[model samples]
Target: MDFALVGLIASLILLMVLALKGMDLLIAAPICALVVALSNGLPIFATQEQGDIANYSDSYLGGFSQFLKVWFLVFLTGALYGKLMEYSGGAKSIAHWIIEHVGMKRAVTAVVLATGILTYGGVSAFIAAFAVYPLAASLFKQADLPHRFIPAALALGSVTFTMTSAGSMEIQNWLPAPYLGTTPYAAWQVSLFTALAMAAIGIYWLNRMIHTAYQQGERFILPQASIIASVEAEQQQNVNPLTAVLSLLAVFITAFLFHQDYSNNALVIALVAGCVVLVVGYWRQLSQHFTKVGSEGALGALIAGANTSAVVGFGSVVKATPAFAFAVDAVTAIPGSPLVSAAIAVTVIAGITGSASGGQTIALPILGPIYLDAGANPEHLHRTISLSSGVLDSLPHNGYVVTLIRAICGESHQSAYLALAKMTMVVPGICTVLALYFLA
Candidate 1:
């Protein structure tokens, strides 16, 4: 790759490091993007390069706007949906039902699995963690489980929610072509498979950790209320169980219809149906929740999307021009069997976006075409790649991880890293290895 392309790669790494170091994502992303822009000599668009340097600022602004458009509706609707659920007693009601059925012994596991399932319903982990943590914290405390387990449980829950949630309208999942183009229907099937794999692995790991903690009586490591207490008190409600379930069912029905014709947006239809259910079930009560959903959801979604918006935009800009094209080619040029190449592509792309969705966006666009060109099974390759993307996305540096850790645990720096590692490293590793074995 050329020096400029190499610099673009280096800048991306630096951006992650900055995020890990507690830099604001908005600042870090733009700075990193600017660095990439300067390094790659990207001046907004291609036409401007041959023209003048005066258009550099315009390019940056234009790129920023493009990212905003992608993140705005996706994150807004998703976030609002969560907020609405919070206000309407939907999430809590679900958690309460789960606890009532599973009993405290299995509460943590139940919460994680349930969150994963709900994510498939277009729920973001940000909303899931907030919605579930209070209920989970109360149950974990009653069970005399370690306090640390609360945040850990929450982190695990978010991973499943964000990674493979059923009808997710997450920009990374729904809108982005790079992520699903190579796989198509693979999103649905693999989404389910990954949820199961992640849950099994997460359960095994959680049990192992708890067992070890109890055996050693490592009281220091267990979750404390202090970790997630603030979030619980300040929590918002959205949709009740009846609404969430009915809404979700409508989504399933719509999805079936969508299968008959691929042009419809599953998320838009699902959320709309869900909102209808909410309104129908509890008119005035639902109206009260709408404001909470609008404000909180918008804020939360904006927070998450801002970091990614700039990063995705800048990354796309860098990838588009000749300056960073060499880096793109170089990654694909790595020598391996097509299968191995596919796997590497999945892992690499996932790591790039620090998100499963993002990975799909970055890698799938490029990787999908390559895999298709190489004549790989579109379903298998796409599923494999999509699932693998979740691995790195669960890492502490990832936007979702940091957002939940900070929001739930109320800790920063290294406090949540342990919980993050439990989900991101141990859990995802187990799942990924199993997938590799199965796919192999």
Candidate 2:
């Protein structure tokens, strides 16, 4: 038995377990990195090797630093954008406007569309969930829709179609660019079709599930009276819906105009533009909370950036191990289209890691070189891996799923997760398969 391989596998398992147990990734990731280092016989500090030093700190921090170097701005701006939208009453205004226009008859659709718009505009999904939840709850309550389905509607809008689709400002869509030398608009033709498919099928399935639950006599259950009052209080903010729409459009327009010229950096510019729009557009509404919101947004960005960086650090350690090399060899050796192999490898690793970004961070460094050398289309490969990453990464144990269902929505997985799974996992998985068939 290869003890080193065993340690790698063990570390991966522990990472997932710790994450699912609500442990901070900052602590869990480093501990797991130490495990892989010890098992693989790496030096804890530094060692002289062929006129250079080989050390665990270098490898671990190297990956962490590299990710931050490349993505810190994006993360910072994205969080601030989300925060401005939230604190300025812009996000709520948008939600209320959509609900009003769509009407109570299609309350779920309104909530989902609201979330989709925010997420596609580059707001963090977590922030989008929190910002939209109050509106979603009120809508469901008014429509007599089951409250348990709230997470599903939010997750569907935030993660499935808009998140992975071409031209999205999400990091998942942008992460592959530097590695593949492709723009965020990679394979956009196929992405448009796949996104439409996911939207149509996922929305239909989600509505069907809600309708089924309603038919079975399930209806919205009011939360504790205190919780209701808190939610209602949160939803009482007033802001002009038109200004909010323009704030969102500022992000979309800036990104659209600059993406071709600036690539991923366009997102930073776009988010900044959006923030300025919100601040100016809703100055009176946000004046009291401006300082607080900016500080909170910065703090949120730090936490999110650190979490992703920690996992990337773990991947850095994994990359230096013999086990990772062997695994890479095995994956690349699979007999089939390189796109198919890339998709399978990325999706499986994403499922295991419980993070699409983490999985792609680990796999792309190895697969990018191999596939590009094998004459694969860089644009197609980018789209394939991005779409595939979203599929299995939404497993029950995933951090995002847990946060959305339990932490944010205050609902148990037993009731909410079925709808969540259909919209996120199943829908994305089907789209990934179809993407391979059509793009390959």
Best candidate, TM-score-wise?
2
lDDT of each: 0.61, 0.85
How high is the lDDT of residue 16 in model 2? 74
**1-440, model 2: which lDDT tens digit per residue?**
29989998898888877876778888888899889988988777875553345557888899899888888999999988888888877887887778778988887788889999888878899988888888888888888989999999999899988888888889999889889998888999999999889988887888888899899999988554212446567667587878777867888889888877887899899999988988898888788997888799899999889888887888788788787777778888989899998998898778756678877988888789989998899999999999999998887657678888878888877778888988899999999999999888
| Candidate 1 regions with alpha-carbon error over 4 angstroms | 1-10, 39-49, 52-64, 67-71, 165-184, 187-194, 220-240, 259-264, 317-327, 334-339, 436-440
> After aligning candidate 2 to the native by TM-score, how far in Å is the CA of 47 from where it should be?
2.9
TM-score, each model? 0.83, 0.93
lDDT for each residue of candidate 1 in 1-440, tens digit (9 for 90 to 100): 37676767787688779878778766776677677777766664446346654334555566567667645665666676666666777767776667667887886677775565566666677667776777776666666666566567777766643554334444444433334353134546545666577777777778787777768765433234344444345334444467667765665566546633453245555566666665676566676566666777778878867766655655555555565455557666767545456666656656655656555555656667776787766556655665566666655457766666665655564655675576765676566556555554
Point out where model 2 deviates above 4 Å: 48-55, 222-230
By summed lDDT, the worst window of 10 consecutive residues in model 2 runs over 222-231
